[model samples]
Target: MTKRQKRMAAVLLLLAGLSVAAVLGFTAFSKNMMYFQTPSDIAGGKLPEGARIRLGGLVEKGSVQRGEGLVVNFSVADCDANLPVRYEGILPDLFREGQGVVAMGHMDGKTFVADEVLAKHDENYMPPELAEKLTTPDGKHSCAQFKSMGGST
Candidate 1:
């Protein structure tokens, strides 16, 4: 082959290798991606069956129940819905009702089985995603509105 043909073949081979690498990278990224969802999204049946996700919301008041050992059950609530979560582990020191929380887990039938639970570290802090869902029109966190949306007082 001519020198020009050799160069063209080399370029094509390089392009093919880059394309394959790109595909593999994207595939791995998609597989490892964990999406964030709110209680409303889960209540609307937007969760894919058995897919791991981060559920962010406020822990509803009067919904915490302690079971044997470290098992605890509570409801995570948004402005319009609530999702029950069951977790079997020591909770964070800051975890409590009426606080923002993000639980990492998957659904078990109608309930969320959490593998990890993260509570907001401070009284004023809320996750950006959860804040967006719970913020009122006046740009304030509205506990009254949350209660009106089906959350417990």
Candidate 2:
């Protein structure tokens, strides 16, 4: 090939390689990304279909129920709705009712089948994602926000 043609071909090949790399990078990022949402958002059908998500909210009082073995069922509630969650493993030490939590998993029909559950580690600590969503108009975090909307403690 002529020198000019060879250089053109080389440029085209480089562009093609870059395009492939970009596509692969975007695919990997999207596959690994997990979105955070509240129970109200889930109720409104804001969940991504078949994608793993993090559900963040207050654990509803009187909702924790232990099933056979390590499986446990509970509800996560926001101001407008409550989402049922099922987890089949040992829970975090801080997991309990009336506390902020973030559960990572995918929706199985109407319930959130959590592969992992993370609870607030202290009285003053709430997950940043959950805190941001639940912040009061006065800029204060309030679990009472859920309680007033027919959620438990």
TM-score of each: 0.58, 0.58
Tens-place lDDT digits, model 2, residues 60-113: 878889999999999888766788999999888888777778899999998899
> Where is model 2 more than 4 Å wrong at Cα?
1-35, 121-141, 144-153
Q: Name the 10 consecutive residues with the lowest summed lDDT in model 1.
A: 144-153
Please give the RMSD to the true structure for each candidate, in Å: 9.5, 10.0
Candidate 1: tens digits of C-alpha lDDT, residues 1-153? 999999999999999999999999986675244345677666755556999888877788888999999999999887777899999998998798777788999999989999999874434666799977875443225332332212211
Residue 24 miss distance in model 2 (angstroms): 26
Residue 46's lDDT in candidate 2? 49
Off by over 4 Å in 1: 1-35, 121-153
Each candidate: how many clashes? 0, 0
